[model samples]
Target: MNKFNMTAIAVAVGLIFSAGMMAQTMSKDDYQAAEATIADKYKADKANCDSQSGKQQDICIAAAKSNKNVAKAELEARHEPSAKHDYDVVVAKAEADYAVASATCQNKSGNDQDVCMKEAKAVETRIKADAEAELKVLNANKTAGKEYTETGMKEKAEMTEARQEAATDKLEANYAVAKEKCDALKDDEKDSCQDAAKMKYGK
Candidate 1:
C-alpha cells in the first residue's frame, strides 16, 4: 500500500489497541505487570521475525511491534499524569514558537519581509517535522511494519518538498514587489535597496 494508506492503517491499529486496553481497568501494579508482559512479547516477536528471511515476515513483525508500542504509549498516557503533561508542554511550545516566528515575519518589508515570513514558516515546518518524526519513532518502536514506516517517511519528504516549492514561489512574488518599491527611490538609494532585497531574497 501507499505511504498515506499505510500510515492510516497504523493509526487505526493504534486507536484500536488503545481502546482495547482502556476497556480493562487494572491496579497500578497490575498495569505494570501487563506492560512488562507486552514488552517481552514484543521482544520475542522481533527475534522470531528477524530469524525469518522474507518480506512478508518482516512486514508482519514490524506491524506487530508498532501496534504494541502504540498500545503501550496509550496505556502510559492514561495512567501516567507526567506523560500527558510532557506531551502538552511540547505541543504548547511548538505553537508558541510558530506564533513568534509568524509575528516576526509580518514586521519585515518587501522581499526581506517575505523572506522573514518564509523563515517563520520554515520554523513551523521544522516543528511539524519533529512531531512527525517522534510519532514515527513511537510507531516504529511499537513494531509498525516496515512498509508503514517507509511510507510515512516518504510522505513526510514529499510534504517538505511541496512546502519548499510554495515558499520559493512566495519569495519570488515578494522580491518582485520589493524591486518595484526600490525603483521609486533615487538612483543610489534604489540600487542599494535592490541589492538589499536581492541579498535577502536571492537572485
Candidate 2:
C-alpha cells in the first residue's frame, strides 16, 4: 500500500489515543495515575507500530509519538487546569499532527509529496494561529477580570480575524490538494479540475 494508506492508519491510531486520554479534572493524587496510563498507552501504541515494517512502521511510530505527546499535554491540562496549560495541550496536538503529516509526506515523491507538505504546513499554521488568538483573548479577559458574556470589541475583532484566517487556510489547503490531483489528468480534464477547484473555493 501507499504511504497515504499508512498515514490513514496512523491517524486512526492517534484518534484512538486521544479518546483514551479524556477524563475529568485531576487531583494531585490522580496525576501519577494519569501519567502511568499515558505511558502504558504509548507503550501499547508503540508495540503496534513495532509490528509493522518499512514506511508503515515509520508512520505508525510517528502516530504513537504524537499520541504520547498529546496524552501528556492532556494530562497536564487536567492537572493544572489553566488557560496556559490548555493552550499548551492544543499546541502539542497541533505540533504532533504536523509531525505525522511531515513523516507521511516524506514517504511520497514528486508533486504529491510537495503539495502534501504544503497542505500540512498550512493546516498547522491555521491551528497555531487559532490557538494563539484564543490565548490572547483569554489573557486579555483574565487581565480585565471580565466574564465571557462581557467580551470587548477588541476580543470580538480578534475572533473575527481568526475565523477569516482559518477559513482562508482551509480554502488554500483544499485548493492545493485539489490542484495536485488535477496534475494526473489530461489537458482539458485538468483544466476542468482546476476550474472546478477555483469555483468551489472562490480562489
RMSD of 2: 6.4
Q: In model 2, which regions exceed 4 Å deviation?
A: 1-24, 144-203
lDDT of 1 by residue, 129-200 (tens): 444444444444445344557766666565566556546655765676667667668889989999999999
Write down the lDDT that model 1 would get: 0.54
> 1-203 in candidate 2: lDDT tens per residue?
23463345334432433343354577777899889888999999999887789887888998899899988987887776666666677778777878888888878898778778777766666566566656665555554454444456566666667667756766777777778778878999989999998898797
lDDT of 2: 0.71
Clashing pairs in 1: 62-143, 62-144, 62-145, 63-145, 65-142, 65-143, 66-142, 66-143, 66-144, 69-142
Lowest-sum lDDT 10-residue window in model 2: 9-18
The Cα error of candidate 1 at residue 91, in Å, is 3.5
Winning model by TM-score: 2
- Which regions in candidate 1 have their CA more than 4 angstroms from the true location? 1-88, 144-203
